[model samples]
Target chain A: MRVGELSRRTGVPVPTIKYYVREGLLPPGELTSPNQASYTDTHERRLRLIRALLDVGGLKVAAIAEVLRAVDDPGRPVHKVLGAATERLGARHAEHDDQEAAEAGAAVGELIERRGWRTDKSSPAAADLARALAAMGRLGHGAFREVLDDYAEAAERVARADLGYVDRKVAVEDLVETTVIGTVLGEAVFNAMRRLAHVDASARLFGTRPEASD
Target chain B: MRVGELSRRTGVPVPTIKYYVREGLLPPGELTSPNQASYTDTHERRLRLIRALLDVGGLKVAAIAEVLRAVDDPGRPVHKVLGAATERLGARHAEHDDQEAAEAGAAVGELIERRGWRTDKSSPAAADLARALAAMGRLGHGAFREVLDDYAEAAERVARADLGYVDRKVAVEDLVETTVIGTVLGEAVFNAMRRLAHVDASARLFGTRPEASD
Candidate 1:
């Protein structure tokens, strides 16, 4: 298979495929001749993964490169790979570190302690939560913090379902790839559904839709 | 209060505040003395909402302006406002409308039907879900559709909790404002918590953390 076929099969442009190779996102294909190289099925699969992460996972190229490095390495611990997979998502909010941030941090600490959740206290997810809460505080919606426990309960169920899917469906060798897909695309799935649910609930409360229109 | 004081209170710069006013995201302050403008509490609150939507909701400035316009108009229906609030988020992925997208749309239709979800069939969230699934299919993880039911169940729980919070905690007058806060920041809250729960679950499976580190 030539690079053109790889591009055709993956629906990625030829130059974009070359750029990925240069970025080390995709390994260079076998160089059978000085000018032309042949790609394989692995190249096609890797290209698809890159597209999925970009289109759905919303990870930056650098973050995808890092996660791919971990996936390609055999000796990396599962926890370390998991950490890499989530690194980019944690910093979506800038940590302002102001008074509101301090208060938000304390609330996150309290929620974790109350839930007895066993995670690194200084984890990125905790920091992400605090930064988000601080943004809310700045907006005068600090009182919305009252529902952290409820959000945590919903998160717990989501996580449990994720674990069950991972444990039952994937082979041990495919852990890193599966983690990236499940974590990133899975988030998109839930966010869209939550919005749909919001519309449904509103229709129920308001009279825009028929009361029994299934 | 003057524009400077409003900026001081909201932590937005004076120039940025003016930009918001110019963008119609914030109502212009009253004409005070030809060259000066006087702002009020409404300006301050609106400024905060604009900042929150930009920072946490990750919505673009244009989307925020549209949502604010919808929010300011009392004649708007609840569903319409929600539709406006979620307008930007639905287009995160390019709607390729390829074969994979076509299949994904069918899957979303099936899920909505199975759940008896009362939503506009042509809603943005459903399209968003289909786009995400199309990306997954491109990655060769179409089998992941098997877990859509599990994801939907968790989403139902989250929607119920959001509705409960919106119902009991807010006044009728504050419905649109509360919906934006809840829909956007609440999204941040759940996403971060879901990541936290992932770390905890991985700890249970891997041995990097103490088995009983409560």
Candidate 2:
């Protein structure tokens, strides 16, 4: 197929496809002649993945490029690839090494020790956790840490389910991409579910329906 | 105190504070004299909340303004305020009224019925859930719904913890703000913890350390 057909099939504009090719997010098609190139099934698949990451995952082009590099690199371990994909899902911010952030980082270290997790304290995910906690502390909600264990328990259950689903994939080659989709889109699924549950729980507790108030 | 003091205390720059005021996310200071304005303790608290919502919550200024309006409206029900705040946390996209989206919406409706949740299907959260499921289906992961119950269970646990914390607040006036904070920042906290737990669970399952692979 040519770029025009690819664009028509995927609903992505031709120029955007060319832009993705230019940005190294999508590979260029084989040139049949001057100004004529052919794309394969793999290109179609890759283009869909790129659209999913950009639209639903809300990843920037540069971050998507990094994630794709990790995804395509066979030398990288599965867990490392998963880390690269998941890290990009987080809000990118400069690390604040202030007193509160330091305290929060120490607390995160304690949580890791208590949980016996085998990840590094310097990991971006760990830093994100620290930043969130520090922000909470600044807002006078420092006691939110009291419920960390519950969140961890829930997280463990969700992670188990996630890994179980990924492990069931028949092809080893499909594992990394499946993991990336599960992590990014799965977050959206869980967040929406949480909001629905919040409505249900709040209604049960308050004896008032949210829609009724609307 | 003055606007300068509020800026110093909250660590928000004066120009940004002025921007928030101009955007209606923060109230204007009381004019004490020509070219001099006084901000109260309420101003300080609101400034901190604004910064938290902007930085940690990742809400746009317009959405923050709407949420703040809901929070300030004494006539609005607590559940309504919560619904308003929670709805804004989702990615605001135009609803895809295609067949797959309709099927996904039906599945979400069934999940709500099965779970006995009290929210309407028309809610933004429900629509967001449908959109996520539809996206997953497009990605060949429609079976992701197989794990919805697990995600819902975890969501219920977290929501219960959230409501319990809010219920413990001494002032009725503070309930809405607390719910917004819990919904937004609590999500960041849970996501980080989930990633950490993923590292642990994947390590145990694969017998490989993530950091070792790094």
Candidate 1: list runs displaced more than 4 Å. Answer: A210-214, B97-99, B207-214
**Which pairs of residues have clashing backbones in candidate 1?**
none
Return the top candidate by lDDT: 2
- Top candidate by TM-score: 2
lDDT of 1 by residue, B44-134 (tens): 8888788877877677888787777767778766677666766545645644758889899999998989988888667778888887888
Query: In DockQ terms, which candidate is top?
Result: 2
Model 2, runs deviating above 4 Å: A94-99, B212-214
Question: Tens-digit lDDT track for model 2 on A1-214?
Answer: 9999999877789999999999999999999999899999889888878887777766779888988887888877777887877776678753455677888888999989888888878787787888888887877787787788778778888998888877775268888888778877888888888899999999999997766434
CA lDDT, every prediction? 0.80, 0.82
TM-score of candidate 2 to 2 decimals: 0.94
